[model samples]
Target: MNSNYHISSFCKIKNNEVSLNGSVIYNNENNNFSAFIKAAYKSLETNYAKFFKMDALSKLAFLAADVLLKNEHLNPEEENNIAIVFSNKASSIDTDRKHQQSIQNKEDYYPSPAVFVYTLPNICIGEISIKYKLFSENSFFIFDAFNAQHLLDNTNSLLSTDKTKKVLCGWVELDGDDYEAFLYLVTNKGSIIHNKQNIVKLYNT
Candidate 1:
């Protein structure tokens, strides 16, 4: 693993608002979750002229990728090492709920394949990769909660292999009535000035 690798920037969205913009650490000033969701839906409407009832995990991943892709410093086309490693606790439970609901009602037993496809947790990765045109290693994991050690371990393993030059990794978790997301753009080239303390300060800010 590249010991030199550090997180450059990250963004998170949840509860209908952006919890963090593209920053090395958390920033409460940008943590209006409801507003973030509104902005994301607006952006999607403007770009795609369509929208779906996306769950918390999907919303968080899409918003994070949007911020990452727009970073002027990162060159996606030139960055062949770019990859995505995301995790969630619920693992598309919202989609499963809808799918089940569709089958529960005999009058509405028609299942939309489009909706069914998103029932998998990794579908969010596919959505982000398609948006970014990233044909690189992608993975998804499920944990009971935000397991920092697991994140670090998995990311280090990926970086160690040198198969990916850069990794976009983080946790996107949602439980009943609660949601949180944390993402990082890890690269060996850039420097990270923020540590845990810095993260706390930024979150308080």
Candidate 2:
């Protein structure tokens, strides 16, 4: 049993507020998602230019993952075993809406391949894997609501298998200007237990 799994760090970003490990890092009354994400990226001092082309949902996931990995010592061997497990209610619907609008009119029909690529929610996982050099197992799930049980079960299952040493799991939901992300890194080291109840408390708290 992977009973030793623990949550080392957590990051929650949404409602114009960003928190790391239960402490608020950035907060504002601003309601703009893209602008705030851009600000967060700049604040992290990351030089990834591809961030500018990502859709809003991917941007949110990318920033949240970046915040979790910031200034942390990552073992090169362990990096490949770091898996991602993400969930959302919208599941790329925000970008789907934009992609639909791109061809709504024949007079101005111009669908973008760049924008089209983000229609699948799992693409963000790929983006994160590429950015952080993670090549381990990963999956993205979409549910009607936040299901901490499913997330925890799958996370533990991955860890139980010897294929992965750590799992980054959470909800990264978005629609228009409304968005929320609560991401946590679970491993064998940390005080917090990686259970369903704890995940719910961390997300709601």
Candidate 3:
């Protein structure tokens, strides 16, 4: 794998906590992922109305991506060349649970297309791609846990491709009131080497 890629910046939201670049930015007393996400959104001043309509999986991914994508180091000239690769343990399981609940019984059956839209794991990437205007390669993977080796390998492979310039890679998982997202921007420039060890260290931090 080419070592040209570097980690520009990263953000982590685990449980009721929020951190950026290994520093704690927000810590909530209550263990509510929704509240924590919205608090971070308001604090960051992300004025996107569509955020409300997104499922928890998309919201988690969008919030983390919003943080990394805002950096000036990201060149708009090659935005389309920026690919997104994400992994998660749940794979939109929280939204799936809700959708299942909505149709569990005929007496209360009211299936929602809105909720159904996010049943697929890749929907979060779709939401992010639409919001950020990324038209290049994008994919989502499901893992038992954050497999640093897989992420590192795929990122390196994508960057090795002549078509891809930079990549937004990370993990997004949510289940009911529990959620965690560790996202990073990998570019040809930055201080930290975009490798497995450092990626795992950043996620752990």
**lDDT of every predicted structure (CA atoms):** 0.64, 0.86, 0.83
Q: Indicate which candidate wins on TM-score.
A: 2
State which candidate, 1 or 3, has the greater lDDT. Answer: 3
> Which 10-residue window of candidate 1 scores lowest in summed lDDT?
22-31
Q: Predictions ranked by TM-score, top down?
A: 2, 3, 1
lDDT of 3: 0.83
Of the candidates shown, which would achieve the greatest lDDT relative to the real structure?
Answer: 2
Ranking by lDDT: 2, 3, 1
Q: Which stretches of candidate 2 lie over 4 Å from their true place?
A: 75-79, 108-110
Candidate 3 per-residue lDDT over residues 1-205, each given as its tens digit: 6788899889888867667777777777767777777887788776789998999888888988887787544554554567999998888788888889878854766788888888998988887787677988888999999999998988888888765888889998888887889999898999999988899889877
Task: Write candidate 2's Cα lDDT for 1-205 as tens digits.
Answer: 3569999999999778888998888776768887788887777665689999999999889888888876356653455568999999889999998889877844676787888899999998988888778988999999999999998999899888877988889999999999999999999989898887788999999
Q: Which clashing pairs does model 3 show?
A: none
Q: How displaced is residue 44 in candidate 3, in Å?
A: 1.1
Worst 10 residues of 2 by lDDT: 71-80
Residues 107-164 of candidate 1 have per-residue lDDT tens digits of: 7568877678778888777767765667778899988766656666666677778777
Number of backbone collisions per candidate:
9, 0, 0
Error (Å) of candidate 3 at residue 89 is 1.2
**lDDT score for residue 38 of model 1:** 52
Ten contiguous residues minimizing lDDT sum, candidate 3: 71-80
Error of 3 at 113 (Å): 0.7
